[model samples]
Target chain A: MINVLVGSTVLPGNLEAVLEIYRELVARTRNEPGCVSYELLQLREDPCDLMLLECWLSQEHLDAHTRTPHFVEAIAQLEMLETAAPALIYTKSV
Target chain B: MINVLVGSTVLPGNLEAVLEIYRELVARTRNEPGCVSYELLQLREDPCDLMLLECWLSQEHLDAHTRTPHFVEAIAQLEMLETAAPALIYTKSV
Candidate 1:
């Protein structure tokens, strides 16, 4: 499996709005083929910071999800709400 | 709980040696007070890359663990095997 960790920070005062979008995005993402697990986490100390952690069956599976309509829409919406570009790392399970 | 995700890269051919150190570290860490979970994961695609994902009762608890003898010892050994500084993110649950 491939483990993906992404850290995204929302613009000031837009945490709720951004999280709502992610709620929908997460719902859709979890149903994608080869998606093993998908979760959205918020930082307790820094509420503006969020994490998207996912486990996928393979890189191909993740690539397919990124190309989906929901993913595209979420990215477009997030561009305006994010304080900075998200930090992402992908690790393959040994 | 505070979730800590750390990504560490081992020098070429040092994966086994580092993992052994971590095996002992993980065992000791799991026994620490306020430790919720502690795990060491290796990247399947990039065997040299490793991840230490932990959940602690609080930041104070984590700080305490870092100051412990086992942690201090592991850090000394890891300094020689790590190729790059680890990437760390601490997230609070919402």
Candidate 2:
């Protein structure tokens, strides 16, 4: 499986709302084919900093996930909430 | 539990040595009092890029881990192998 971490910094006042959106998105994402695990984590030092740890069967599976309606919708909302673009890192199991 | 992702870029030609060091460190760290999980993951696109996903019972537990002899030794070696200082992000479980 492929491991991916997507990091984003949410605007100060938008964390709760953005978190709700992520909750919905993660719920939907877990049901997609090839999804092994998906979780949203909030930084303790800066609660507005968020990270999503995702495990998928393959790069293709991940690409497909990005194309889904849930992803598209979530990304649109997340873009508005984000202070900057997300940082995505893809890794393989050791 | 506290979730921490520590990201680092290894100096080229140092990946194998660093990975071995990490393997040993993870083995030792897993036995630490508050360590829930400690794993090393390498970026698929850039093998020299590494990330360590760590789970600890509390910030105090994490701080203690940092002071351990094994940690001190491993970190010293890691510093020499790293292209830059590691980026550490601590988050709470959602």
* Each prediction's number of clashing residue pairs: 2, 0
What's each prediction's TM-score?
0.72, 0.87
DockQ by candidate, in order: 0.33, 0.54
Highest lDDT: give the candidate number.
2
Quality class of the docking in candidate 1, CAPRI style: acceptable
- Residue lDDT tens for model 2, A1-94: 7888887788878888898888899899999999998888887778887788888999899999999999999888888887544455566544
> Candidate 1 lDDT, tens digit per residue, B9-44?
987688788888888999999999999978766665
User: Which 10-residue window of candidate 2 chain A scores lowest in summed lDDT?
Assistant: A84-93
Model 2: runs farther than 4 Å from truth? A84-87, B84-87
lDDT of 2: 0.82
- Best candidate according to DockQ: 2
